[model samples]
Target: MQNVFSEENIKIISQIDNWQKAVEIACQPLLEEKKITQKYVTNIIKSVKKYGPYMVLTDYFALMHAKPGEGVNQLAMSLLVVKEPIDLEGKKVKIFLILACPDSKSHIKTLKEVAGVLMDQCNFELILKGTKSQIIDLFQKKEMDGGKK
Candidate 1:
Protein backbone atom coordinates (compact mmCIF):
# COMPACT_ATOMS: atom_id res chain seq x y z
CA MET A 1 0.00 0.00 0.00
CA GLN A 2 1.07 3.57 -0.52
CA ASN A 3 1.98 5.77 2.39
CA VAL A 4 -1.10 7.35 3.84
CA PHE A 5 0.91 10.00 5.63
CA SER A 6 3.84 12.13 4.61
CA GLU A 7 6.07 14.55 6.49
CA GLU A 8 4.02 17.39 5.12
CA ASN A 9 0.83 15.77 6.34
CA ILE A 10 1.71 15.75 10.03
CA LYS A 11 2.26 18.29 12.76
CA ILE A 12 3.22 18.39 16.39
CA ILE A 13 2.07 21.28 18.49
CA SER A 14 2.30 22.04 22.13
CA GLN A 15 -1.24 23.34 22.58
CA ILE A 16 -4.28 24.94 21.01
CA ASP A 17 -6.52 27.64 22.41
CA ASN A 18 -9.74 25.74 21.74
CA TRP A 19 -11.28 22.84 19.89
CA GLN A 20 -12.13 25.01 16.90
CA LYS A 21 -8.58 26.20 16.65
CA ALA A 22 -7.42 22.67 17.09
CA VAL A 23 -9.47 21.54 14.10
CA GLU A 24 -8.12 24.34 11.95
CA ILE A 25 -4.55 23.60 12.89
CA ALA A 26 -5.03 19.92 12.37
CA CYS A 27 -6.30 20.56 8.85
CA GLN A 28 -3.52 22.97 7.98
CA PRO A 29 -1.22 20.46 6.34
CA LEU A 30 -3.88 19.16 4.00
CA LEU A 31 -5.09 22.69 3.39
CA GLU A 32 -1.64 23.84 2.36
CA GLU A 33 -1.23 20.86 0.08
CA LYS A 34 -4.53 21.72 -1.61
CA LYS A 35 -6.01 18.37 -0.66
CA ILE A 36 -8.93 20.21 0.91
CA THR A 37 -10.43 23.66 0.66
CA GLN A 38 -11.20 26.22 3.33
CA LYS A 39 -14.81 25.20 2.98
CA TYR A 40 -13.93 21.71 4.17
CA VAL A 41 -12.52 23.16 7.35
CA THR A 42 -15.59 25.29 7.92
CA ASN A 43 -17.84 22.33 7.24
CA ILE A 44 -16.14 20.24 9.89
CA ILE A 45 -16.61 22.95 12.51
CA LYS A 46 -20.22 23.32 11.49
CA SER A 47 -20.78 19.59 11.72
CA VAL A 48 -19.31 19.48 15.19
CA LYS A 49 -21.54 22.35 16.23
CA LYS A 50 -24.61 20.58 14.89
CA TYR A 51 -23.63 17.13 16.18
CA GLY A 52 -21.69 17.92 19.35
CA PRO A 53 -18.27 16.33 19.44
CA TYR A 54 -19.33 13.25 17.53
CA MET A 55 -15.92 13.08 15.92
CA VAL A 56 -14.21 12.52 19.22
CA LEU A 57 -14.15 8.81 18.55
CA THR A 58 -12.55 7.90 21.85
CA ASP A 59 -10.84 9.52 24.78
CA TYR A 60 -7.82 11.59 23.69
CA PHE A 61 -8.47 11.02 20.01
CA ALA A 62 -10.58 12.55 17.25
CA LEU A 63 -11.14 11.82 13.60
CA MET A 64 -12.39 15.08 12.13
CA HIS A 65 -13.98 14.95 8.73
CA ALA A 66 -16.78 16.24 6.57
CA LYS A 67 -18.62 14.59 3.72
CA PRO A 68 -16.92 14.14 0.37
CA GLY A 69 -17.10 17.17 -1.96
CA GLU A 70 -17.68 19.66 0.79
CA GLY A 71 -14.39 20.87 -0.67
CA VAL A 72 -12.16 17.86 -1.11
CA ASN A 73 -9.62 17.76 -3.95
CA GLN A 74 -8.42 14.24 -3.25
CA LEU A 75 -8.17 11.49 -0.71
CA ALA A 76 -5.73 12.49 2.00
CA MET A 77 -5.16 12.48 5.73
CA SER A 78 -3.43 14.81 8.14
CA LEU A 79 -2.31 14.36 11.69
CA LEU A 80 -1.99 16.80 14.52
CA VAL A 81 -0.64 15.75 17.85
CA VAL A 82 -1.20 18.22 20.61
CA LYS A 83 1.30 17.67 23.36
CA GLU A 84 -1.14 19.29 25.72
CA PRO A 85 -4.62 17.90 25.55
CA ILE A 86 -7.42 20.18 24.40
CA ASP A 87 -11.08 19.99 25.34
CA LEU A 88 -13.74 19.02 22.86
CA GLU A 89 -17.03 19.48 24.61
CA GLY A 90 -16.46 17.47 27.79
CA LYS A 91 -13.78 15.20 26.32
CA LYS A 92 -10.07 15.85 26.23
CA VAL A 93 -8.29 15.12 22.96
CA LYS A 94 -4.59 14.99 22.15
CA ILE A 95 -4.58 13.54 18.65
CA PHE A 96 -6.52 14.86 15.70
CA LEU A 97 -6.82 13.06 12.38
CA ILE A 98 -8.17 15.29 9.62
CA LEU A 99 -9.36 13.31 6.62
CA ALA A 100 -10.35 14.59 3.19
CA CYS A 101 -11.61 12.24 0.56
CA PRO A 102 -12.91 13.05 -2.92
CA ASP A 103 -15.56 10.36 -2.65
CA SER A 104 -17.14 8.24 0.07
CA LYS A 105 -15.56 4.99 -1.00
CA SER A 106 -11.96 6.15 -1.13
CA HIS A 107 -11.60 6.76 2.58
CA ILE A 108 -12.86 3.44 3.82
CA LYS A 109 -9.62 1.53 3.45
CA THR A 110 -7.49 4.30 4.84
CA LEU A 111 -9.93 4.76 7.70
CA LYS A 112 -9.82 1.08 8.54
CA GLU A 113 -6.04 1.05 8.33
CA VAL A 114 -5.74 4.00 10.67
CA ALA A 115 -8.33 2.68 13.08
CA GLY A 116 -6.69 -0.71 13.09
CA VAL A 117 -3.34 0.79 13.98
CA LEU A 118 -4.74 2.95 16.72
CA MET A 119 -6.85 0.15 18.12
CA ASP A 120 -3.76 -1.16 19.80
CA GLN A 121 -3.37 0.63 23.10
CA CYS A 122 0.36 0.55 22.77
CA ASN A 123 0.24 2.10 19.31
CA PHE A 124 -2.15 4.79 20.51
CA GLU A 125 0.14 5.83 23.33
CA LEU A 126 3.20 5.84 21.09
CA ILE A 127 1.42 7.94 18.49
CA LEU A 128 0.21 10.34 21.17
CA LYS A 129 3.78 11.01 22.26
CA GLY A 130 5.60 10.32 19.01
CA THR A 131 7.63 12.63 16.86
CA LYS A 132 6.50 13.04 13.26
CA SER A 133 8.96 10.51 11.89
CA GLN A 134 8.25 8.14 14.70
CA ILE A 135 4.56 8.26 14.00
CA ILE A 136 5.11 7.66 10.30
CA ASP A 137 7.43 4.80 11.05
CA LEU A 138 4.96 3.23 13.41
CA PHE A 139 2.21 3.36 10.84
CA GLN A 140 4.45 1.88 8.16
CA LYS A 141 5.60 -0.83 10.50
CA LYS A 142 2.04 -1.70 11.42
CA GLU A 143 1.10 -1.91 7.77
CA MET A 144 4.04 -4.22 7.10
CA ASP A 145 3.08 -6.31 10.10
CA GLY A 146 -0.39 -6.78 8.64
CA GLY A 147 -1.81 -4.29 11.16
CA LYS A 148 -0.51 -6.23 14.09
CA LYS A 149 1.34 -4.68 17.04
Candidate 2:
Protein backbone atom coordinates (compact mmCIF):
# COMPACT_ATOMS: atom_id res chain seq x y z
CA MET A 1 0.00 0.00 0.00
CA GLN A 2 1.12 3.52 -0.70
CA ASN A 3 2.21 5.34 2.44
CA VAL A 4 -0.29 8.15 2.91
CA PHE A 5 2.07 9.92 5.30
CA SER A 6 5.04 11.03 3.24
CA GLU A 7 8.33 12.01 4.90
CA GLU A 8 7.85 15.65 4.03
CA ASN A 9 4.33 15.56 5.37
CA ILE A 10 5.55 13.96 8.56
CA LYS A 11 8.11 16.70 8.94
CA ILE A 12 5.41 19.30 8.55
CA ILE A 13 3.08 17.51 10.95
CA SER A 14 5.78 17.16 13.55
CA GLN A 15 6.49 20.87 13.36
CA ILE A 16 2.91 21.72 14.23
CA ASP A 17 3.26 22.56 17.91
CA ASN A 18 0.86 25.51 17.73
CA TRP A 19 -2.16 26.70 15.76
CA GLN A 20 -0.12 28.80 13.33
CA LYS A 21 2.21 25.94 12.50
CA ALA A 22 -0.77 23.62 12.20
CA VAL A 23 -2.46 25.93 9.66
CA GLU A 24 0.65 26.36 7.57
CA ILE A 25 1.63 22.71 7.52
CA ALA A 26 -1.90 21.47 7.03
CA CYS A 27 -2.41 23.78 4.03
CA GLN A 28 1.03 23.29 2.44
CA PRO A 29 0.29 19.97 0.78
CA LEU A 30 -3.03 21.23 -0.48
CA LEU A 31 -1.33 24.28 -1.97
CA GLU A 32 1.29 22.09 -3.62
CA GLU A 33 -1.38 19.81 -5.07
CA LYS A 34 -3.13 22.89 -6.53
CA LYS A 35 -6.16 22.07 -4.44
CA ILE A 36 -5.84 25.57 -2.97
CA THR A 37 -3.95 28.74 -3.85
CA GLN A 38 -1.21 30.45 -1.87
CA LYS A 39 -3.45 33.42 -1.16
CA TYR A 40 -6.16 31.19 0.25
CA VAL A 41 -3.67 29.33 2.36
CA THR A 42 -2.28 32.59 3.67
CA ASN A 43 -5.74 33.75 4.58
CA ILE A 44 -6.46 30.57 6.46
CA ILE A 45 -3.11 30.60 8.22
CA LYS A 46 -3.61 34.21 9.22
CA SER A 47 -7.11 33.55 10.45
CA VAL A 48 -5.98 30.63 12.58
CA LYS A 49 -2.94 32.51 13.80
CA LYS A 50 -5.11 35.44 14.83
CA TYR A 51 -8.25 33.84 16.19
CA GLY A 52 -7.32 30.21 16.71
CA PRO A 53 -8.93 26.93 15.52
CA TYR A 54 -12.12 27.27 17.49
CA MET A 55 -12.70 30.66 15.95
CA VAL A 56 -12.29 29.17 12.51
CA LEU A 57 -14.91 26.57 13.34
CA THR A 58 -17.22 29.24 14.69
CA ASP A 59 -16.76 31.26 11.51
CA TYR A 60 -17.45 28.18 9.46
CA PHE A 61 -20.71 27.45 11.21
CA ALA A 62 -21.79 31.08 10.97
CA LEU A 63 -21.17 31.16 7.24
CA MET A 64 -22.91 27.85 6.74
CA HIS A 65 -25.98 28.94 8.64
CA ALA A 66 -26.25 32.57 7.54
CA LYS A 67 -24.59 32.47 4.09
CA PRO A 68 -22.68 35.58 5.11
CA GLY A 69 -20.03 37.47 3.10
CA GLU A 70 -21.62 36.90 -0.31
CA GLY A 71 -20.55 33.25 -0.09
CA VAL A 72 -17.00 34.04 1.06
CA ASN A 73 -18.19 32.93 4.46
CA GLN A 74 -19.45 29.69 2.96
CA LEU A 75 -16.14 29.20 1.22
CA ALA A 76 -14.33 29.76 4.50
CA MET A 77 -16.70 27.30 6.11
CA SER A 78 -15.93 24.59 3.57
CA LEU A 79 -12.22 25.25 3.81
CA LEU A 80 -12.15 24.64 7.56
CA VAL A 81 -13.94 21.32 7.30
CA VAL A 82 -11.98 20.14 4.27
CA LYS A 83 -8.76 21.07 5.98
CA GLU A 84 -9.25 18.52 8.75
CA PRO A 85 -6.18 16.31 9.04
CA ILE A 86 -6.20 13.32 6.75
CA ASP A 87 -6.29 9.89 8.32
CA LEU A 88 -2.66 8.89 7.88
CA GLU A 89 -3.36 5.70 9.84
CA GLY A 90 -5.55 4.38 7.00
CA LYS A 91 -8.26 4.49 9.66
CA LYS A 92 -10.44 7.15 11.15
CA VAL A 93 -9.86 8.36 14.70
CA LYS A 94 -12.28 11.07 15.75
CA ILE A 95 -10.53 12.67 18.68
CA PHE A 96 -12.55 15.43 20.27
CA LEU A 97 -11.23 17.83 22.87
CA ILE A 98 -14.07 18.37 25.26
CA LEU A 99 -14.69 21.92 26.38
CA ALA A 100 -17.20 23.77 28.52
CA CYS A 101 -19.85 24.91 26.06
CA PRO A 102 -23.53 24.34 25.54
CA ASP A 103 -23.05 23.14 21.96
CA SER A 104 -20.46 20.66 23.09
CA LYS A 105 -23.26 18.28 23.95
CA SER A 106 -24.38 18.21 20.32
CA HIS A 107 -20.88 17.29 19.20
CA ILE A 108 -20.89 13.99 21.06
CA LYS A 109 -23.38 12.33 18.70
CA THR A 110 -21.60 13.62 15.62
CA LEU A 111 -18.20 12.63 16.96
CA LYS A 112 -19.53 9.16 17.72
CA GLU A 113 -20.75 8.93 14.14
CA VAL A 114 -17.33 9.97 12.94
CA ALA A 115 -15.73 7.26 15.09
CA GLY A 116 -18.11 4.67 13.72
CA VAL A 117 -17.29 5.73 10.19
CA LEU A 118 -13.60 5.47 10.90
CA MET A 119 -13.89 2.02 12.43
CA ASP A 120 -16.04 0.80 9.57
CA GLN A 121 -13.43 1.98 7.12
CA CYS A 122 -10.53 0.50 9.11
CA ASN A 123 -9.48 -0.38 12.65
CA PHE A 124 -9.46 2.93 14.48
CA GLU A 125 -9.71 4.67 17.86
CA LEU A 126 -11.53 7.72 19.16
CA ILE A 127 -9.39 9.72 21.51
CA LEU A 128 -10.41 12.61 23.77
CA LYS A 129 -6.99 13.86 24.69
CA GLY A 130 -4.63 14.91 21.88
CA THR A 131 -1.43 13.35 23.11
CA LYS A 132 1.14 12.34 20.50
CA SER A 133 2.07 9.06 22.18
CA GLN A 134 -1.57 8.12 22.66
CA ILE A 135 -2.27 8.83 19.02
CA ILE A 136 0.70 6.70 18.04
CA ASP A 137 -0.52 3.93 20.31
CA LEU A 138 -3.90 3.96 18.60
CA PHE A 139 -2.28 3.36 15.23
CA GLN A 140 -0.02 0.67 16.68
CA LYS A 141 -3.01 -1.07 18.24
CA LYS A 142 -4.90 -0.76 14.98
CA GLU A 143 -2.05 -2.47 13.16
CA MET A 144 -2.27 -5.34 15.62
CA ASP A 145 -6.03 -5.49 15.15
CA GLY A 146 -5.61 -5.60 11.42
CA GLY A 147 -3.31 -8.56 11.75
CA LYS A 148 -5.91 -10.39 13.79
CA LYS A 149 -8.71 -9.57 11.39
Candidate 3:
Protein backbone atom coordinates (compact mmCIF):
# COMPACT_ATOMS: atom_id res chain seq x y z
CA MET A 1 0.00 0.00 0.00
CA GLN A 2 2.53 2.56 1.25
CA ASN A 3 5.78 2.24 -0.66
CA VAL A 4 7.96 3.84 -3.29
CA PHE A 5 5.22 2.66 -5.67
CA SER A 6 2.68 4.88 -3.95
CA GLU A 7 4.71 7.91 -4.91
CA GLU A 8 4.90 7.71 -8.70
CA ASN A 9 6.55 4.29 -8.78
CA ILE A 10 3.82 2.69 -10.85
CA LYS A 11 4.10 1.97 -14.59
CA ILE A 12 1.46 0.79 -17.03
CA ILE A 13 3.32 -0.66 -19.99
CA SER A 14 1.41 -1.80 -23.05
CA GLN A 15 3.77 -4.72 -23.67
CA ILE A 16 7.28 -6.08 -23.39
CA ASP A 17 9.27 -8.41 -25.63
CA ASN A 18 10.45 -10.57 -22.80
CA TRP A 19 10.38 -11.11 -19.05
CA GLN A 20 13.82 -9.54 -18.63
CA LYS A 21 12.54 -6.36 -20.22
CA ALA A 22 9.56 -6.55 -17.91
CA VAL A 23 11.90 -6.59 -14.94
CA GLU A 24 13.88 -3.70 -16.31
CA ILE A 25 10.84 -1.55 -16.99
CA ALA A 26 9.42 -2.36 -13.60
CA CYS A 27 12.66 -1.18 -11.98
CA GLN A 28 12.64 2.13 -13.84
CA PRO A 29 11.23 4.20 -10.99
CA LEU A 30 13.78 2.79 -8.53
CA LEU A 31 16.55 3.30 -11.05
CA GLU A 32 15.48 6.89 -11.70
CA GLU A 33 15.44 7.57 -7.96
CA LYS A 34 18.77 5.77 -7.42
CA LYS A 35 17.13 3.37 -5.04
CA ILE A 36 18.77 0.53 -7.00
CA THR A 37 21.64 0.18 -9.39
CA GLN A 38 21.51 -1.29 -12.89
CA LYS A 39 23.34 -4.26 -11.48
CA TYR A 40 20.26 -5.05 -9.41
CA VAL A 41 18.20 -5.67 -12.53
CA THR A 42 20.97 -7.78 -13.99
CA ASN A 43 21.20 -9.85 -10.86
CA ILE A 44 17.47 -10.43 -10.82
CA ILE A 45 17.48 -11.69 -14.41
CA LYS A 46 20.38 -14.00 -13.67
CA SER A 47 18.55 -15.39 -10.69
CA VAL A 48 15.49 -16.04 -12.81
CA LYS A 49 17.56 -17.80 -15.46
CA LYS A 50 19.30 -20.06 -12.98
CA TYR A 51 16.41 -20.65 -10.58
CA GLY A 52 13.40 -19.92 -12.80
CA PRO A 53 10.56 -17.48 -12.20
CA TYR A 54 9.46 -18.57 -8.80
CA MET A 55 8.29 -15.01 -8.60
CA VAL A 56 5.24 -15.94 -10.66
CA LEU A 57 3.26 -16.17 -7.44
CA THR A 58 -0.21 -16.62 -8.93
CA ASP A 59 -2.35 -16.11 -12.00
CA TYR A 60 -1.67 -12.84 -13.80
CA PHE A 61 0.87 -11.89 -11.14
CA ALA A 62 4.59 -11.94 -10.57
CA LEU A 63 6.75 -10.36 -7.86
CA MET A 64 10.17 -9.38 -9.21
CA HIS A 65 13.09 -8.88 -6.89
CA ALA A 66 16.79 -9.34 -6.21
CA LYS A 67 18.26 -10.50 -2.93
CA PRO A 68 18.66 -7.82 -0.29
CA GLY A 69 21.89 -5.85 -0.54
CA GLU A 70 22.22 -6.73 -4.20
CA GLY A 71 22.46 -3.12 -5.28
CA VAL A 72 19.73 -1.95 -2.95
CA ASN A 73 19.98 1.62 -1.70
CA GLN A 74 16.82 1.47 0.36
CA LEU A 75 13.69 -0.44 1.07
CA ALA A 76 11.37 0.60 -1.71
CA MET A 77 8.99 -0.98 -4.22
CA SER A 78 7.65 -0.48 -7.76
CA LEU A 79 4.75 -1.92 -9.69
CA LEU A 80 4.31 -2.32 -13.43
CA VAL A 81 1.10 -3.49 -15.04
CA VAL A 82 1.92 -4.78 -18.49
CA LYS A 83 -1.20 -4.53 -20.68
CA GLU A 84 0.05 -7.48 -22.67
CA PRO A 85 0.96 -10.48 -20.57
CA ILE A 86 4.55 -11.66 -20.17
CA ASP A 87 5.00 -15.32 -20.94
CA LEU A 88 7.21 -17.15 -18.48
CA GLU A 89 7.66 -20.64 -19.93
CA GLY A 90 3.90 -21.17 -19.71
CA LYS A 91 2.83 -18.80 -16.92
CA LYS A 92 1.51 -15.41 -17.94
CA VAL A 93 2.46 -12.42 -15.85
CA LYS A 94 0.42 -9.24 -16.22
CA ILE A 95 1.56 -7.57 -13.03
CA PHE A 96 5.15 -7.02 -12.08
CA LEU A 97 5.77 -6.08 -8.45
CA ILE A 98 9.40 -5.12 -7.98
CA LEU A 99 10.96 -4.48 -4.58
CA ALA A 100 14.32 -3.14 -3.47
CA CYS A 101 14.93 -3.86 0.17
CA PRO A 102 17.85 -2.36 2.03
CA ASP A 103 18.18 -5.53 4.03
CA SER A 104 16.43 -8.80 4.71
CA LYS A 105 14.21 -7.56 7.50
CA SER A 106 12.88 -4.44 5.81
CA HIS A 107 10.87 -6.09 3.03
CA ILE A 108 8.65 -8.62 4.73
CA LYS A 109 5.83 -6.33 5.79
CA THR A 110 5.55 -4.58 2.47
CA LEU A 111 5.86 -7.83 0.57
CA LYS A 112 3.13 -9.39 2.67
CA GLU A 113 0.78 -6.51 2.01
CA VAL A 114 1.50 -6.66 -1.71
CA ALA A 115 0.98 -10.39 -1.79
CA GLY A 116 -2.35 -9.81 -0.11
CA VAL A 117 -3.45 -7.50 -2.91
CA LEU A 118 -2.36 -9.93 -5.57
CA MET A 119 -4.10 -12.83 -3.90
CA ASP A 120 -7.45 -11.15 -4.24
CA GLN A 121 -8.88 -11.57 -7.74
CA CYS A 122 -10.92 -8.39 -7.55
CA ASN A 123 -7.93 -6.31 -6.55
CA PHE A 124 -5.71 -7.84 -9.20
CA GLU A 125 -8.38 -7.22 -11.86
CA LEU A 126 -8.70 -3.64 -10.78
CA ILE A 127 -4.97 -3.24 -11.36
CA LEU A 128 -5.16 -4.76 -14.82
CA LYS A 129 -7.97 -2.47 -15.97
CA GLY A 130 -7.10 0.70 -14.09
CA THR A 131 -5.47 3.77 -15.57
CA LYS A 132 -2.20 5.07 -14.17
CA SER A 133 -3.98 7.47 -11.80
CA GLN A 134 -6.62 4.85 -10.99
CA ILE A 135 -3.91 2.32 -10.25
CA ILE A 136 -2.19 4.76 -7.93
CA ASP A 137 -5.47 5.48 -6.23
CA LEU A 138 -6.14 1.76 -5.81
CA PHE A 139 -2.98 1.29 -3.82
CA GLN A 140 -3.59 4.50 -1.92
CA LYS A 141 -6.95 3.15 -0.87
CA LYS A 142 -5.27 0.00 0.33
CA GLU A 143 -2.75 2.06 2.27
CA MET A 144 -5.44 4.12 3.92
CA ASP A 145 -7.44 1.03 4.80
CA GLY A 146 -4.33 -0.62 6.21
CA GLY A 147 -4.08 2.09 8.85
CA LYS A 148 -7.72 1.90 9.96
CA LYS A 149 -8.60 2.85 13.53
Model number with the top TM-score: 1
List candidate 3 stretches off by more than 4 Å.
147-149
TM-score of each: 0.94, 0.32, 0.91
Question: Against the unseen true structure, what C-alpha lDDT does each candidate score?
Answer: 0.88, 0.31, 0.81
Write out the backbone clash pairs for model 3: none
Error of 1 at 8 (Å): 1.1
Tell me model 3's lDDT, rounded to 2 decimals.
0.81
| lDDT tens digits, residue span 50-101, model 3 | 8887888888888788788989998888888999988975789998888788
**TM-score of model 1 vs. true structure:** 0.94
Native-to-model Cα distance after best TM-score fit, residue 121 in candidate 1, in Å: 0.6
How far residue 37's Cα lies from its native spot in candidate 2, in Å, is 0.5
The positional error of residue 84 in candidate 1, measured at the CA in angstroms, is 1.2
On lDDT, the leading prediction is 1
Question: Which residue ranges in model 2 land beyond 4 Å of their true spot?
Answer: 1-12, 15-17, 55-149
After superposition, which runs of candidate 1 have C-alpha atoms over 4 Å from their true positions?
Answer: 146-149
* Selected candidate, larger TM-score, 2 vs 3: 3
Give the lowest summed-lDDT range of ten residues in model 1: 140-149
